[model samples]
Target: MIKILKEVFQLYIDRSDFFLEILLQHMAICGIAIVIASIIGILLGIIISEFKKTTSPVLSLVNFIYTIPSIALLGFFIPISGIGDKTAIIALAIYALLPMVRSTYTGIETIDPAVIESAKGMGSTDYQILYKIKLPLATTVILSGLRNMVVMTIALGGIASFIGAGGLGVAIYRGITTNNAALTVAGSLLIAVLALVVDLIIGTIEKFIKRKWKLN
Candidate 1:
């Protein structure tokens, strides 16, 4: 184990460029997926929150998709989208919907009814209420969801290399096949570190937002 650790450390230092290339690939894949999930998830969340009637069915569908195994979902998309980052992004985005939508809904729903009524009394337009009141107020919770989605997406991005998406997973899968423990361990560590770094950044943002809100 010590020998393997030494080898992995040397590879990280000596071949930083090689790892950096794949790291960018991983970020691009996961970043696109996160954006897609946030847009559609937030939209669905808003819609369900407003309509209330649609909440059960919309959430139920998202929940169902979220429950599908990531690999199986990727396989299902392969025939239509074929093998590439697109398919991986789609799969990751789908998996991400539950957290984003749930948080958005919960954040909006939990806001005191009186606050909204006060906004209405102040002659706030629907758009103004949503833009200024609901979203701004719900941002902390939404950001919390964003953090989870990002971390989860990055971890899942590793599997994307399996479908030719090209990410840290390449190192991991290739290492597994070729029995290169250092490569495999290095890839796993990079993915984990990426997740941790991203989570911490978002957590910091959440803290800042919370503090600002409290001050107000």
Candidate 2:
């Protein structure tokens, strides 16, 4: 194990450029998917929150998709997407939806009903209430969901290699196939580092949002 570790450390020193490229690809894939999921998830959350009857069904559907294994979810998109970053994005976006939707809904729902009533008394239109009151207050909770989704998407981006999505997963799969434990460990460690960096950045953003909104 020590020998493998030394070899992997050497590999990292030798192939820093290659690993950086893979890391960028991983970030690109996760970034795009999360953006797409955020747009759709936030909309779905707003809709379901407004239309209480739809909440159960919509959440149930998103939860079902979230439960599907990442590989299997990617496979489901293969026929139409034909295996690549696009397919991976689609799968990751689907995987990200549940948390986004749930958080948005819960955040909005948990707000004091009195606040909403006061908004209406002040002649705030529904749209005004949503934008000025509900959404601003719920920002932190929705961001919490986004933070979780971002971390998970980065981890899953590694699996995209199986479908030619080209990320750190490439190294992992290559290591497995060629019996290069060093490569596998290096790839895995890079991924872990990437996830940590992203989470920290998001955590910083969350803190800023809380302070700005005076949620603390």
Candidate 3:
């Protein structure tokens, strides 16, 4: 174990630039996917809550999407997007939708109906009520989902290399092919660390949102 750690440390020291490049690729893939997913998911979530009749069907479909295996889903996209970061980003965005959408839906749906009613009573329009009441109250939950989506995307981004997308997974796959356990371990450790660091940052944002809303 110590020897492996030493080897990984040595690898990091010897190949810092290469590792940094791989890390950046992984971050870029995750970052882009998360942003795209956030816009679509949040919008869908808002629409789902507004159009009550569509909620059941939409939730069911999103749940079904969550069950699809990531690799299979990625492959399903290859014929269209044709393998690369674009394909991986699309797949990650789809997978990320479930969490973001569900959270957004839950966040708004769970808001106190009385507050909305009060807002309406004050001559607030539908848009005003939603923007002021629903969205503000839902920020913490939405942020929580965002946190989950970011971490999940980062973790999954490692596999993007399988589709010719450059990332840390390249190191992992190369290590596997070359019988280099240390390289595999290093790649995996870096991915895990990246996920952890991002999660922590998101978590901090969540806390700030909670405090802003005095949710606690």
Give the top-scoring candidate (lDDT). 1
Model 1 Cα lDDT, one tens digit per residue, 3-90? 9989999989998998999999999999999999999999998999999899999999999998898988988999999998899998
Write down the lDDT of every candidate, Cα atoms only: 0.93, 0.92, 0.91
lDDT of 3 by residue, 1-216 (tens): 999999999999999999999999888888999999999999999999999998999889989998999989889999999989999999999999999999999999899889888888899999998897899889989999998888888888888888988889989989988999999999999999999998998898888877776644
Runs in model 3 lying further than 4 Å from the true structure: none
Rank ordering of all candidates by lDDT, starting from the highest: 1, 2, 3
RMSD of each: 1.0, 1.4, 1.3
Q: Tell me which of candidates 1 and 2 scores higher on lDDT.
A: 1
List runs of model 2 lying over 4 Å from the truth.
none
lDDT of 1 at 212: 94
For candidate 1, give the lDDT: 0.93
User: How do the predictions measure up, each by TM-score?
Assistant: 0.97, 0.96, 0.97
Q: What residue pairs are clashing in model 3? A: none
